[model samples]
Target: MVKSGKTKKKYHKPTKPHHHLNPPPAQANKPISVKTLPAHLVLEILYRTPVKSLVRFKSVSKSWFALINHPTFIKMHLDFNTSKNDKNKLICSCGYGTFIDIALLSLSEEPMNVLRINKDFTERPNYPRKINFRDFSKNMVLAGSVNGIVCLSHSEEMSERFVVLWNPSICCWCPIALVETKSWDNMSVGIGFDEVINDYKVICIVPEFRFEDYGWSRIEVYSTNQGSWEDVDKKGKIHFRPNTDLNHCNFIVNGVPYWAGLDLRPGYVDVLGRIDPFTGLFKKIEHPKHVRNEITRVNPVKLRESVAALIQSPGDYPNNVIDLYLLDENTTKWTKMYSIGPLVSGNVCEEMQIPQCFSTGEIILETWTWDTDQDHVTDLDLVHNIYDPKTKLVLHINHMQALHPCWYESYSHVESLVCIKGMVQIGKEHRDKKTKPKMKNWTEFLSKEFDSVLHL
Candidate 1:
């Protein structure tokens, strides 16, 4: 009885309510602190990123957005990508009607393929269709591309011609004021950037009409910084005939525009004219000796910081040879760097159009071929040949089979964050004022179809 009583007497303290008590500290998990990188270091890393990545990264933060959109950052990114040879997408336009198809070509892959299709700029639904045939030709000419901006004219001969500066990368466009010109004129327009003024310029060359024949050209320039067109002085006007093939003949190299120049007069050699973007003045440079006599086509391309010309000529039976000449800016001399074959057998390339050249010495050639016996152009053999200068190996890519080459027009484009409206703000805006409405109708239709399939 005594033992039982002693054991039962032991009592526990009453439990207390701890409702207002403080919680235990977060278990020694690593202390959370955001370690922001230095601004310059962050910018250096962003500059090395791809343009598409940069565009998407704009949503990261306010500071990141501002850094990506800064002019200095944009230029630094461009220069960095250019140095790395990362900005080498070829944009090609095919077919002309109510809608056009613009395909982005990727040569970075082993077998080049279409990277993306941009129908937004091609489908100019707001454009007036009542324009005349001549006007239509001028508007759809696809003058050329420079630093991701493309220039298009609507009226070449009229006093008031409508022009568009479009940046396909951002899907933004600006219509330039009507460009005024003289009567009975043939005009060639080229757009380029001026590093000196840090502005974009448009060069218009109208050949003088002399007794129903082409003669000395009158040059006019439009500066985006000034937002007006001005006449180039007589000294700045070139005497040679402008190349009719503006798409292939005109190119921008190191912020200057180069065009294939020809003098119909006897003993006058064909030259490459370099137009100064700031002053509108031009200087003629001699062509390489080998391709001077039998030049079928001349493509001026960017080679390093200077310029290079791709010259093509007919070779032995069922073959063609392409020669690449680089210009020494100091001496103004042409030095031959590469000589691509007498292409492979059975592949007769009639017209060789070079869209781009990589710093790795790879040349992307777009060619059109014809049947030897039929003497007519054949669309079956539309191919893009990538020639490696070091190995002299050619990789044939059948572009026609994939893109159905209907009036193929290709240009080398470097993707950029440049705003067309920023460059030409005086003109009407082409970008939609608001974001495009979500495809509600299509989404609903697809959902209903899926439900029906599930029930079935």
Candidate 2:
């Protein structure tokens, strides 16, 4: 009776023979430590990750933190990215007065019918303080960007104005002390890196008050390594076209700042005045061809290994074509690279600014244009064109009219982990007092800036 009362034996379900035949790999449950990875493999992994990821990984462990912050690692990562033909992004600053808007546009090989607003600058950490365009009466201009650091200055009538050096990647920024110059009129500033000294520099050109008709300009340079401004040794005898629109005059190419020089003479030769920040030498390069009697705009851009000029003809609205010419580094000969457009059928290009051209033959250009239905008197629309020289394929990217102005500032930037403050020591006292605030999580910050802008 006791045996009968015992519970019936539970039926056992048969397991698959394969399940018992093979157990999980030993390393499956126990994740391999990153420390166990070969050093070269680890470095390769870090190099491929985005800068924001590297910044956060600095907290993973002391070893990782040190490695991420190490100067050697930083340089290697930058080099790797630069060599990999990474897509260059366009950073655009629009709006005027207190409501200035900043955005980033990601360029892709895939044809895009519409230009998507990438990231808004307002939502970014360490962005320069907003100034009322009405109060200042001037739009903020991006002086130049080098190694992911952008120098921003607002139009202030004062002889001395504040300039901000910002690293959007790390969200770090430092304001250079008030830059004092002879005249704010016709003044231009540019930022560039010096490979020899491994330093970053800011070059300022201020018109010298003079009676003579010949336009004269003075040069002052601020070295990040020195953390101070010094008059260029050959400051005198510097000449720039009087009344030059400094806003569009300066750009960086191959670690040098090139300022557009007005043809003071009757001859219509466009000249680019280049300054080597390291040696502080100034030289002028003549345009590819003497543009005959036409109002031409010359944009000096870095094209692969050498500097190239993107020249627009008849510099007025409703233009039909653009000429690209690359400079020979050794001979200084300007060779015609490609003739872009008869653009999109209905669009009339008013102005074109070429930011960057890759060795892969893709050229990024910002154009201000108007639809054929719209007259020249109408406001020009902002358009971005990605032209493939090889295939002559043009991808027209139309953006929101509200976000882009007739005169927005744009720069081509490569991603880097460079520290803004580390580029050059600001003063010890200034550095201690003006430490950059911590940035919000990049993923979260980007989402907020782009959520409303990007619908696709």
Candidate 3:
């Protein structure tokens, strides 16, 4: 009846389902529970992990990788490894490359055990026999160690040289060209951390050789982030010797590098030069009045398993007596701490200063003096001695003819001597004292304490 007209109930399209276009509530993207893990628990877990895991963990998840990659985390891992008893490791470099030998030295009533680090160990890394030189010479300088990362630099070859950076822990290396080789001088390289930039820097100092510009030195700094070397402008009256001994001129402290020089005057007085990576500037640092004379050599040392130091010595060759100066992080001051004495002539004849020092107030030393009168080359009085500066005691540790590298790593602690094929731990053989003194051979006694690091 209707006017067929009226739309037979015009039907609107079925109402579309009103599903919101928003993502499914973000799946409650809750953060990881790393924050919930107790600091001690997290540190404990990290302690059992190796450096490679730590480096890779940074990308696992923002929270995880960040927590694990933090410098603080690395530091915590180091502290935990160190505190778990005295883990001593001896690292050496020779024609064969760098080798690390681990020994356990527990402070308490634990027995000494020599733990073996297999080529496959998680914490230990094996290096190639002949490390390829990136751009420079065959020689490399072991600059400093921080959080298990050993910093090193390559010297320019006498023929053609380049500089490189390496971290032994992770087996990471980067070689870079020396920007200002035009001077054709044997350049010097130094590495340290620049706090201002929170980056590590490598400094190369090329002494200007032209007689006209006698004391002038051209300096360049390599920044890791920038991946380039930049020349630093500095004004100082420096005297140049065509072939001067440049080894002692540069040193690293608390991540900053320093250069040592003399007055540059007629008879230049020894001057210590420091480079501030932040300002890219160089300034002379006055030595403690006590260290003025004495053909001094300033170099870095592993003050402990974790700390870096500037070790000053009047001399390390042939001198039976050696003194140590530790770098103070807060003050940037070199504190003269201990001396290995005038050994009764027969007791010790020749000595090589061991560069490693530990907070335990113990130091490792090496010597090669012999009474047999054997040819200097053949004569073997090589002895590794543990010197306790706190107690004024020195114990013969190991012996060899000519110890190579002279420095190496130990577990969480720095090690000096181990019974490697070419090396020998002769401490047990030379028990000279039939009578046990009060202090006794605590050094030898330490061996009986913690033999090796083993997991229970």
Candidate 4:
């Protein structure tokens, strides 16, 4: 070794590793970067996700925000959800005599399959996720539900009735012009979609009250696209009734609303009434001959694409079968589809104390026992049963009893993005910031599922 005046260079190791050893394998459990995913694939995964999850993802990036908010994407999401039976739900109102709580029941495909897979019925489905209605309305009637939008009508007896179109999935509401109810009674409210106009419309069929006026309902329609209400029918020919229960499905067919009402003519005739969504015109339909002579009340329900009647067979008090008759819209006649016997015999759809066969082909029977005198409901006993058409067996889901009035009625619901255009301001969560629970600073970065990495 030679020693020079200059300091010797410090020894250092080379960065290149030996060729004998291979680099450690990439982490097997590592998450894939969203950047690596094609935008179309990312969209495919996202639109199928639950709405709650999608809401949180809006802050991800500008491209994501645009994609999620696009009208085409929203429609695609709604279509995908509707196509999947498991994604269907029912918006319900339940309470005792006084207070009603709105809840969402998961009408899953699995439960229907359970009737086949589990013969013993040991397995129970997890359903009926509870949602608070206090934020929405109190004592308001659920006028109708369409594509996840609920029409909430609040009317004091003999006063003005206001209607609100609420999309619970997105927690946004659009209020329609109020209907002056001081001059109207026996109002029938319905909500449906209009494919021709590509808009959602809410209709109110109410009879104008006058000293000399006979009982005939006038048709008024509120178009969401217009954001205004228009009285379409002035002839006052037919009258339909609402504000009773969650059986509103009995009134709507193929986005058209129908009701069993009276036609005001020389002599009052019981007629099946419907409102043409496109024309906003009122028309009268006749009851099936099988149901007309029976003297038993019939339920006008949406069957396939037309209106159908569920008629009790023979006599009402003592009956052995119930017939389902489909309507030939063009002929204005009824054709018998099938007869439900022994399994669903002697039951009326609205007496509601008896079993009712729905267009979904399930015979559902719900019973409620209320403890009341002159005041509010103190306690309740509710039992719900389902009759499987295929198996011809009735499943007594359970006999549930609860304190306080817990009477709940479920209406048709679909998970959708409608009524959410430029209107997704966070609901109670953002409105009640002071009441929100205190979360850790670090936890804010984590995704809702906790499986996600820090968003920021």
Candidate 5:
């Protein structure tokens, strides 16, 4: 329902900025310098402040600046904010009409607006924000989002496709080098955060075709710290392509990017695949075997536990019922967590994509591609429903109405002060970049047997 228009990007101007994050309400009426505050109090205040506010705090004092920019403090802020229920904000994708608007949705009582990913950026010259990526909206695809950085990939007029890593919190972005492969058209790309090394890695999966069949998948990993891409392994036998669906439940857990495995070799393939960015190899795990006939109806997701799958209940209840199976990272065993529903209210849960859950157990559900006379909504925009399992009530938040085939997608994102390295001026200078571009063809596409999707 978010119409693509010539709207300028607007940052969330926190409604209650009347009181600064540093100076609490007790000192709200006066302009007290942060230097006057005690060291312990200053660190505590800065840790709780939002990223946008913390970015400006770099100008307060040399010590305050050093403290905020320090790796210890940044990690402290990210860890602290990760638990705050109200800190949750969703980066939901609006349709690609003339352009795509990746809007941020708040679970709290904040107003909603378009993120405006367009050509006009800020005052900095050659900033990446100025690039009009929407010109190729047809092939514009989201690789993945990790921490607070979202990586996007698109081919410019059938040329080679490149990757761009963006951190909207600080309005700083950098484009990763273009990935070229002999089987370029069949490659699947994803970006993930390797928490073990504190580095972000971009991975590409390509199935090598030989002897009239797919021999093996050649997997490559790009490390931000090293600023280059390299093959993860020479013999990756389970080199199946990960799911690349824009609306599927592909998520990253503990620095590993997981997508349901989809192989085109004409036999039964594993249901899930997880890549180890550090090691060049990966292992595939089967879906929860306890689901019986409901195995094919299951989807992998990150639940309250580390890695989990949502299984569609076999019962023909009034509404869709989903069960959760948490995979123990240590033991690699599935444990049944809970069920999603039992006709709690509406019957439109079948097409629900991702149900983003805040730290407070409040769930926001977005559904589409179905008709509903229960709500009497005559238009096409999916109803933004809030279902708090604790309260057991579905809160309807109907607003926008767009065309029938609106391709909006949403993913749960946690804001962080993560910074991108090798920042480049993105303007006319990019045209000078050259690479060994390979001819791509549409004959090689990931087999859509089980509808696996991309995750990072």
Candidate 6:
């Protein structure tokens, strides 16, 4: 019928079907052109999510990875996490020889719970087993605790010996070899996370090295995964030891470690050290500013995730307290936060006290009473004062009279036994939920267990 002279139209071979059904139009139900939201709003949403989700989102895109790793963003996220329910445990060890009396306290709720974990345990055949220093012929001291792992160092004949990693939860003990021979005079300890390897590391600093003699500091780092220790060569000509007395605690913020020491003068200044868990490299970070007092002791406490807090008393005595500064991760500048109340109010606050800081905004302070007017500060007894910064109220007050006998015996030189403020809280949990519970808090449950050990 139709003898068309015009060439018939030919359709090209069918390509792969993006969608197959009733052969709908190509642009059927296209994804909506979602408008990009402002970065602030996006950050707010990301910040509200749990740390697990935020960490997972880091791998979504290069933009996200860079954003999350940014110093400012890291600080904000850390602060938000710190404001949540944070639990910290305080451990106090007293005794010169092997038979040291160790006391454990829980700083969770308003009223602090103090439990002495020296009792005997049926599960542990070595109930209240006397830690014999004579066996090793060296005296051991509890250096510090991190994530429920305790560091213990001992010395004999003026030789600083090995350090051990003791986990109180499982009663498992792993001793690290003595990597250095220097005395423990100006030494401090800290543990932190390594994001690159997803493992934990412990750093020990002995400020006993002489800059004029060696022109370098003795910085040591330990990794759990590697099961070894290595020396960190960070400084060029700056001397760490012999410049000033080691006063502050070693603090860990956002997985980085830091401590307080003197700069050129006898005055105090903050010193930062980054531990590369992979290479075990310890490099010194520039101090933001120097404090006034020669005895400017820094109490570095973790107020939140990215916030490393410092409470510096202008002078050695507690009276001249001025400002509490929070360090910014991005600028690395210290910003003055709220002023803390007087160290002593003529209230129940006493001498030989330690302020136990937690991310929960609560400070667990240990106080002792002694006649300052007397010849020697020997008759001091122990007490605890718990304060909540949020409510600005005193939560609990208790006397640690059981530890008085040990204190009196060791009070010959109160300065050496004084616990510094930069000490990290033991039994702290990691951001990873998969990790095991490091702190057992066995004080309540294992009271009978530890009691038998001491009696034996």
Among the numbered candidates, top lDDT falls to: 2
lDDT of 2 by residue, 1-456 (tens): 455666779999998666445557874577666546555666678889998799899888655665676566778788887677654555656554455556555544332211122222244322234322222223446778777787766664422565567776776666665554344555677887899988888777766556774556667788888888866655565655523556533557777877777555555445778778887777767777735445566677766656787777733444546788888867889998777765545544355677556545577766776655544445556666678776888776555334445336555666788884443332232333567675453333322222232221
| Poorest 10 consecutive residues by lDDT, candidate 5 | 447-456
lDDT of each: 0.62, 0.62, 0.47, 0.57, 0.59, 0.48
TM-score of 1: 0.71
* TM-score (C-alpha, index-matched) for candidate 4: 0.69
Model 1: residue 375 alpha-carbon error in angstroms: 7.0
Please list all clashing residue pairs in model 4, or write none if there are none. Answer: 95-405, 95-406, 96-405, 96-406
Q: Tell me the deviation in Å of residue 305 in model 1.
A: 4.1
Cα RMSD of all models vs. native, in order, equals 11.5, 10.7, 20.8, 12.3, 20.0, 18.5
Per-residue lDDT value at 130 in model 3: 32
Model 6 scores a C-alpha lDDT of 0.48
**Clashing pairs in model 1, backbone N/Cα/C closer than 3 A:** none
TM-score, prediction 2:
0.71
Number of the candidate with higher lDDT, 1 or 4: 1
Candidate 5: Cα lDDT at 151: 64
lDDT (Cα, tens digit) per residue for candidate 1, span 1-456: 545544557688999967746544763455769987655566678777767688889888655565566566677777776666655665666544444555666654432332223223344443564332222333355556777777665433332455567776665566565544444245676777787778887777777777645557767777888877765565544577776655333566766777776765554557777778877777778776663334466677765456888877734434467778888888998888777877645634366677666545567777766555465555545666678776789886655345555535455567777774344322233434567676433323323332232231
| Model 5 lDDT per residue over 1-456, tens place | 998979898898767647555766667787656545554565678778878898887787654455565566667787777767577666665654454566666655443443555433334434344443333233445556677777666643322455667666776667665555444555566677777778888876666667554645667677889898765556545646555443222666655667676665556565787778767567777777753443236667655427777666545544367666779776778888667765335433345644444445555555653445776544444555666667677676544223113435445566788786765433333456568654363112322321121110
TM-score to true structure, per model: 0.71, 0.71, 0.56, 0.69, 0.70, 0.52
Candidate 2: worst-modelled 10 consecutive residues by lDDT: 111-120
Please give the distance, in angstroms, between residue 382's alpha carbon in candidate 2 and its true position after superposition.
3.7
Q: Please give the distance, in angstroms, between residue 285's alpha carbon in candidate 6 and its true position after superposition.
A: 6.8
